[model samples]
Target: MGRHSRKGAEAIRPDAAAADPAGRPDVPRPSGGRRRRQGPVPPADGYTPFQDAPQVRGGHPEQREPGGGWGTGPQPRHETTGGQQRSYAYGSAPGAPDQDAAREQAVARQVSAQQAAQHAADGRTARQPAADPGAMPGPRREFVDAFDADPPTPVGTPEARSGAGAAGPPVEPEEAPDGEPAERREAKGGKGRTFTGIAAAAVTTVLAVVVAGQVAEDSAGRGAVARAAGVDRDGSEGASRSDARPTPEHAVTRAPEVKPLSYGEKMAQPYPIAADLKATGKFEAVPGLAKAPGKGQKYRYRIDVEKGLSLDAGLFAEAVQKTLNDDRSWAHNGAMTFERISSGSPDFVITLASPGTTGEWCAKSGLDTTIDNVSCDSAATDRVMINAYRWAQGSATFGPKLLLPYRQMLINHEVGHRLGYNHVSCRTPGALAPVMQQQTKSLDIDGIKCKPNPWVHPGS
Candidate 1:
């Protein structure tokens, strides 16, 4: 039979190597009189204790129960010597005393020398006091024992070196030739930095001044320059804030004064016209109004003139208003009032025209005023016509002596007809005639003669 054949007891389980890491198939278990269970044989080359054996990473052995039959061989290496312990990992072989111990002692000696030298240098410096002289730490334990195990995890790297070096004494500052600190010697370069800063500040100030001058020139413009040079827009210096202004009296212009005519002058100055001069049929109303002067049943009347009449229309208007509104006339004792208007439909239009125009207008209402060349109230229409010839000349009855009363009586007699009154006669002979009497042609009626009257209530 071939030597490689397995017995029934050799089950070739996955944990066979864990039961016996030595890979010695013929070796017996420590149990009494029983053949040892074998593990799979290992390759001759690249053989290691942990390969195919149940072990932890980093070359550490797994803990096994005491009831297992695998404790007879040498124990795999752990992190210790016969009586010493180490914090580093993965060193040379276990129990090899000479080279590993000698190398560790040399490393400890070199670290201790470096710490002693640093302590001596700290003592000689005057600027730095020795730190905690009583509790001064000895040579660092980490650096002294850094190489004792050489574990798979690295040690004494730059990070480990800094942590281990922190417990040591401080290094000394470099000294100047005069025993002053090297930092004091370095202050010579600070003077250059300060000079550079001052020069930059001066440049900044000069630039700021230049910018301000440009801004002022732009803001002031040519007008400000001209003012500062004492010159005006005409290039002359004559006008200034201190120049005197013209006086109020000389600066202002006064209108010429006019004197108004008295009542006598307006009534006496007559405008002459022919007794038979006909004109254009068109009429123009005077443009004004005189409001009633009393609280009574008011009658509004208008003044209209034939287009070519030569008499004073203003005088005629004034005469009619004064005669009617008088206390002795239609408005006596505020019984009634009369207002004259120039527009809209009035109660009556007192019109002045030539005798021919008067005849023409009166004929429209079927009246025969042409027989005596007198005036009439065209009652069916809006006009009460007065003869302009008689207005300009005095009648023979009233004469020039009472020319004003004759004019007033003429307006009243005709306008009274417009007020709904018929011709009335004076009952008393030689007394004032009733204003409704036909005083313009004659004052005689039924052989009774009356003086001229111009008012409804003459005594008032």
Candidate 2:
């Protein structure tokens, strides 16, 4: 019984305070047997509202809503000091979820406007220019950085700067500043452009070869033209200096014993004489002289010995034959014969007489004579008339002991006369006396002897 009674009384102990719908207890009621109604309590932080409120973050309660141009909401407060209950009604439109979203949009707009103003003050546009599709962004950045940096000393003029471009931030492009991509540029035309040193040089070489060929052809054509016009490149003269007749002044006394040589080797070989007859214009070879004769009679050589002459007749004949044979020039053309007569049918003839009687005999017979000797002509035929009478015995010039060389010279001189070479005075200064000169008596010049026997071969 006692446990049941305590349960009823304690279980029925009046609610200490009535709870509101929020599950919080209501304020205490007054004591006097009459219950007192409680008013709204302050927030836990003990905040209060000012009596003459400065302002509300969002204007009026009716306007604080979406699209209502609202700003920040009012500060939180309580009704503690009997000031009118500061009801900060963060309002919402009929379809609005809350007032916070509208406030956020308004703040974003303010920030945008402030940025625009700042950009304008800095003398820059709010929007940047569009980027180019084909430009070098790296070069652009480099250009910008360089532009902002301190300027270098002026290179030229202010007009130069005006012509130059202005600088700014980099604007990247899809392509380079060279106008096109490397691949595109290469494909533009079928010109086949390529880069190479060796190949280019080869092309240049080919071109050079072509040009040289053209130049050579042109030069050849010009030469043909000149020839057709009768203009000679070797001057207007018909003959070379080598073709002219040479004089003893430039003759070389060569040894007839010089061994034969080939053409090229002979050109290199030295001559035995003191002078180079070829270089001095006195040397000549007459290959045509050995050619077949057009005359009806065969060419022949005759040596006529004067009767009672001191020269050995056989030696004379043999010497002449040997000299001619050794030279090969004169021997090729004719046959030689020895004779003794003042007149005969021979092609050539010689006469031997006493030195004392030589001039008398020629004078009596009506013949031409030299200072030391005489030469008689036989009206019958052309002849080599040698008078050995006036020569001193055993002398190089002439003697009873007839020198072979002297006789050869005489024969050559007379034969030359027969061949149309007249007696011309020797002109070589300090030279050997002419083979034609009367060395036995003539002393026209000092320190000079008779000309070499071969001097007439090249036309003395």
Candidate 3:
């Protein structure tokens, strides 16, 4: 501090003070006029001074001291955000302008205050003359957090605080979908963000797996369908001739190409087997039941038709039941009723089969029907085989005119053997032959010619 360190600015320049007419340091006068001060009389007491005592804050130019200059003083603290600035002066002397605390505080950065504080902290203990009680506060070091300072403005504003190089207008707080400030809508603890991230990851994973599965299916299906479809994915024809193939899901499905049958070709029109016909040995039993309607000992039987036979299996089954129970057949007087069955144990299986199939089954019983191409009872197995060839084509003895009776006699003879009857001949000449007779070969045995009969008791 100089000689005016405790006072306001030296308002009257040094020359003016020195050239006073009264020759006093306090009073002054003009050259051509009576000794007087500029515009105002000096007070009885000196004007209040702007203090600049060593190691102490300066004070305002309260009123005015004789010759006080700028120093420092107690300043009101101000805070700002985003770097805005303003300035003003308070408690300034009437005729003297000195450092103002308001102006000091309005500065955006307190660089001077920081330097002053640093000097104080470094133990610069040089003391100056005592300051007036009405002057600035006592000098002391202040330690604070080395926090960064910002000017006053809304957060995230686009404008530069210095008003230079601002690209656009300042930004205001954004509103959320619910109309609240976006900042408020944000999750402070990160819980919302965490949940959102997890959901996104899960969705992504699910989509990836689904896409992968579909890709795998398409890849696997492509080649298999190509050969069948004979069409390629690359718009070419034929699988072996093309590089890419269509997916199986897109492969065309075609119904079997079967020629429709006419009345002559339908199963209703029975087809004849060659005299030398042989067939698959597999058989299918006729399905369902026929109750034993008469009162007598009942016997359940199944009707089986060999596979590949061009004959009506139902007709064969129905004929067996109807013929056996006929008054002229073995079921005469209902000595034993016959029940047709598909399931459960049966007394026997009456099989209508091709000549070859019939021969194989008959051989199981040590019976030979191939010599005459006749039907036989395969007593060794569950089947009583009727030669389908013979069943379809009447014997030469009966001829086609007697075809029905011939078929009836065939069933009666074979099944009769299964009923514990042996072959017999007609005793009385011109009488009906025994049902057990081998009529398929010759109705007249040993020249004892007899009428054809298909009954246990010829009269009954």
Scored by lDDT, the top model is 1
lDDT for 156 (candidate 1)? 28
Q: Tell me the deviation in Å of residue 271 in model 2.
A: 33
Q: What is the lDDT of candidate 3?
A: 0.60
Off by over 4 Å in 3: 1-271
Tens-digit lDDT track of model 3 for 203-281: 6557776777898899878876875678767768863634466657657787889987642233233347787689888
Q: Predictions ranked by TM-score, top down? A: 1, 3, 2
Candidate 1's C-alpha lDDT?
0.63
Cα error, candidate 2, residue 186 (Å): 99
lDDT of 2 at 380: 41
Q: How far out, in Å, is residue 35 in model 2?
A: 99
Per-candidate clashes come to: 5, 13, 14
Could you give candidate 1's per-residue lDDT for residues 1-460 as a string of tens digits? 0012234443343455766788544343343332333433333343334322323356545543322231111112333222222122122233232232333333454456544544443343345455576442333334323323122312423122333324331111233334554334333323333344445544655777677778878867877878876787787984665457665887678787787887656775556788778988788999888988889999999998989876778888989998888888778889888998988889888899888888988999999887777889897788999988888886888877777777877877787788889988888899988888888778888889988887788887
lDDT of 2 by residue, 299-372 (tens): 44445444433334544554444444433224333432222222224454433334334444455545546453
